[model samples]
Target chain A: MSVVDLSKQVALGIDIGGTNTKFGLVNHRGQILAKGSIPTDQYNTPEEFIDALYKEIQPLIDEHGVEKMIEGIGVGAPNANYYRGTIEQAPNLPWKGVIQFADLMTEKFGQPCKMTNDANAAALGEMMYGAARGMKDFIMITLGTGVGSGIVSGGNLIYGHDGFAGELGHTIVKPGGRKHWSTGSEGSLEAYASATGIAITAKKMRAEFPDSMLNQFPEEAINSKTVHECALKEDPVAIEVFRYTGQKLGEALANFVMFSSPEAILLFGGVIKAGDFILKPAKLHMERNLLPIFRNKVRLVFSELDEADAAILGASALVWEK
Target chain B: MSVVDLSKQVALGIDIGGTNTKFGLVNHRGQILAKGSIPTDQYNTPEEFIDALYKEIQPLIDEHGVEKMIEGIGVGAPNANYYRGTIEQAPNLPWKGVIQFADLMTEKFGQPCKMTNDANAAALGEMMYGAARGMKDFIMITLGTGVGSGIVSGGNLIYGHDGFAGELGHTIVKPGGRKHWSTGSEGSLEAYASATGIAITAKKMRAEFPDSMLNQFPEEAINSKTVHECALKEDPVAIEVFRYTGQKLGEALANFVMFSSPEAILLFGGVIKAGDFILKPAKLHMERNLLPIFRNKVRLVFSELDEADAAILGASALVWEK
Candidate 1:
């Protein structure tokens, strides 16, 4: 039997985040013909989310006269499993237990659809169209509310035996310090590198650097974004926070590099918007902590892809590659 | 050109360790037809070692009347690189520079030959004959004086971008504590997991348990074997040492499982002789530290093959698989 010409067809890629669910129609070339996002709260149930998604996305495919050009749908949800085709208990997402979100999409729209965890999807996206495009072995780290990571080796995502291999965020940069959700231990790398963790660190440091410009913001109001903004203004405390956060991230990455020496480590997320604040310190600390042989060989690069578009492109590319 | 038949062909496998170098002729079924080990001396030059190896091995091949029956030769050495077909600056070996060890054999006997790091050879061995015989994505860790590891993914060894992907032993467990050379950090898992490292930990903990039965043995004379013997006697100090060693190893493996997620982690070496004393605690701690999703999934199994012959079979299997 002749296999269908999937390589020429397009796919719908969706990224469901806490605030918004982004959607796009993408072709095999990693090009997004159209894209948009709808507030996640607009849909209370899984059925409502699918309906709202179709309403927002149908027009894009129709506008481009590519409705017939579409072959499948691919989704990147918070806790999705590519193997199971379900999102299981994503803390940030309102869903509970296993949600056969893929079945719902196919039942309603009649298309072949695939899904993977958000971090893995992002990694696939980066490999398909972003900083790591054309690269086979690399890691994508999203320094967001909490640390989430995706690993690609030999052009394949390392989903382990159970499909949850890339948990780079909670690798215990600090053995037993701060309590983090991923690992029960305290002071994990995620506890320090993530947005919420950074905010907590900023609040604690606020007392030490009260005379510094970081004191201008209240403890409750501080976030990774504010810290980045203040660091850019040369606020000593803010700069120190980014430096410390990067140091922890870098050290943890060094350990990871030893396990699988990828060509590069691509960093993304709102926290990374601090640019050099996090990148410079992270590189320094990582070099200091890395094995001598791997010190200069590995590149710690940044992702250039836009977050919303990246997810869609990645999800679409998943189907394209298959 | 007609391809050579391999059904009856055998391969000669040699494992060069610090103390003894083992040699064997193994058939395609991973059965050893002949085998022996010769003491490796620090004072001997590379040329002398090869000469001695040939003297002992030639008779075995001749006695078995297998000169034409042998297909190739494969060597697994302390710091061998398959791509380079040479040993480059192995830590335990006195060799200072690059040595074309495989070429030396091929030149002497005019047989096809290949070489790889010992741990990688073991992985290929497992893939060909032992516990991971059919496994594609798994890691093999050898816990001797120091820890060494090899990775197999997608039915082939992951050479990584640089032929060094499976350095699991070196993946840091303690980021800022006393680092062993292997893991490139202070307080690395290797610092406590390797036989030498475990001995060190046992020696240090000996002070804390001075009143314990283990105190009857002199601290200077304590070693991993003595500690194991003591643990057999239910010595609390020895048990505690293994417990700490298992805990640290388990936590370190938790980090590794997050990266590779192989079907099983195959453990080998003298330290493993303690069996359940080491494995039971290690598994318990590993399960505890593992991501809730990966609690009891990744198996930490031991190699069932005889330790003395496993390396020879593993090395021979390398050529057999190719």
Candidate 2:
């Protein structure tokens, strides 16, 4: 639209996972110009990982003819702190202790860098380019290996005193109902609403109904994806499992609505692929549990970002925010 | 202080309740120069109520030499909407339907006016003058006839889409456990943690322990105050009631901390007067339920504002905020 708008400025986005780290060069409009990945497990230390990552991404910047146009870098990583720019005691990361992630990236690339937990990055991405565009208040719930949430209030992500807010998955949904593996707390939302929780539900259901079709799969093989597939085919036990999961998720969501009063809640990650099989019960239970003022007011929808590029896009949004 | 700071500015603070309405002229330093109350049931219509309120407060303004010094008016009432400046279908208020409360105040006072639900007003008061001063992210829980909450995140109160966010009392704590009187939702925080809930616990404990000291009191006479009195006298059933109440409250608070990661949670109103009787168990259970990252970080403290002046102070804070 203008000379400044059309300028060739870009930013690097890196998403660090336990197994692999994906990096990309992205423009202001959330377009990924070039992207690559490196296996994270190969590095013995964070320094080696950073070295390999920089080597792999340097060519992508040159190939895009934006080596000089590079602005900053933004990273989305587990247990990353926006205020401290460190990842502390993240269980999944290879590093044993605290890692000064953003500082390392800044030093390596000679550019400003920011980092936050992955869920918070997803929230920024949704605000900038996806379902939550033009919205100031919303919650992003990632129902993946473990349930995670990012809360946006007054157009800012809520990083509490410790830079570790928005831990909705750990909120107790059922008092003394189920045990959370990590926190050892009972009836946590993660214990009932996460993908792992769904698989656990399948296992419990199979034991309850010995003749159910869910029994055909080995105990360890019954994951959320398989449960979704079975539910799609009208397997009674699988359908019940999703229904139970939605009920728990919906109830917890109602409580979240009462807390921050977000305009909408965007559901992301693997389990949401079940769609209406999960959404239908979630909506029903959420409405049923909501106080009259919040009933029918909050929109519950799935994340619209492409799964493959969402983390990269989300990280890029952080750079643009700066 | 600057010349402008000493300029004798004041705000009219009004706290509207079901039985009585308290009004006061408060200065920027949270000092009440003049205050009074009127029976709320005297007027059948909202216009009549407004007329009476204005007539009563006009003389107080003149008595305090604050006619020209009055900056604005702020009101704390049930079901008040910050965005629309209206009170919608408040069950406790005498009015039958939606009332354009803030607009009416502005018209009558000839000054700026603002309104929010009573709990949110309390949150503003805390931020300005009470325990939450200098703190941006915190939760204020008012433990009274019903459990009310005001959530402050990123230095702003979260008023969700319909202006009815932060209804923590109605958030389900124990699914299928206790039915809330208002929403009929089972096991809401209000069902167990409010003053009324404490009385119900007393009644239930009396029934369970026929020989207990609580059985000496009539069912209708058992209330939070009486229960506290009994606990002070070492009544086992009453002590157990408070313990159970605190356990439920603490667990719910743990969930809240995980959601927003507030710096502190300020407890206000009648039940908090029980002090350590409630706080100890609440703190214990809350810490027990919190994830390790959040454990022992959140301060659970009683409100510092004088009970008689808190509502007025809270309401007045809204004017200063403008």
By TM-score, who's the top model here? 2
In the range A1-322, model 2's lDDT, one tens digit per residue, is 5465534788898898888888898898888899999998899988899999989998888788898788789899999999899998999888978899888888888999999999999999899889999988899999999988999887888898779999999999988888877778999999989998999999999899987788888888999998887888898999999999999999999999998888999999989999998999999999999988888889998999998898888988888884
Q: Which stretches of model 2 miss by more than 4 angstroms?
A: A1-3, B1-7
* Candidate 2 chain B: worst-modelled 10 consecutive residues by lDDT: B1-10
Residue A125 error for model 2, in Å? Answer: 0.6
RMSD of 1: 2.8
List model 1 lDDT by residue over B228-267, tens digit each.
8889999888998888888888888777776766778899
- Encode model 1's per-residue lDDT on A1-322: one tens digit a residue: 9676654478888888888888888877787878899988666688988898888888888788877778789888887887778888787777678799899999988888898888888899888888898887888899988888998888888776666678777666776778875557655678999998899888888778667777888767799888878888888898898888888888888787877778899998888888888898888877776666577988989887886578788777677665
lDDT of each: 0.81, 0.90
Q: Which ten residues in a row have the lowest lDDT in candidate 2 chain A?
A: A1-10
Q: Measured by TM-score, how close is model 2 to the native structure? A: 0.98
Q: For chain B alone, what TM-score does every candidate structure achieve against the true structure?
A: 0.93, 0.97
Clashes of each: 12, 0
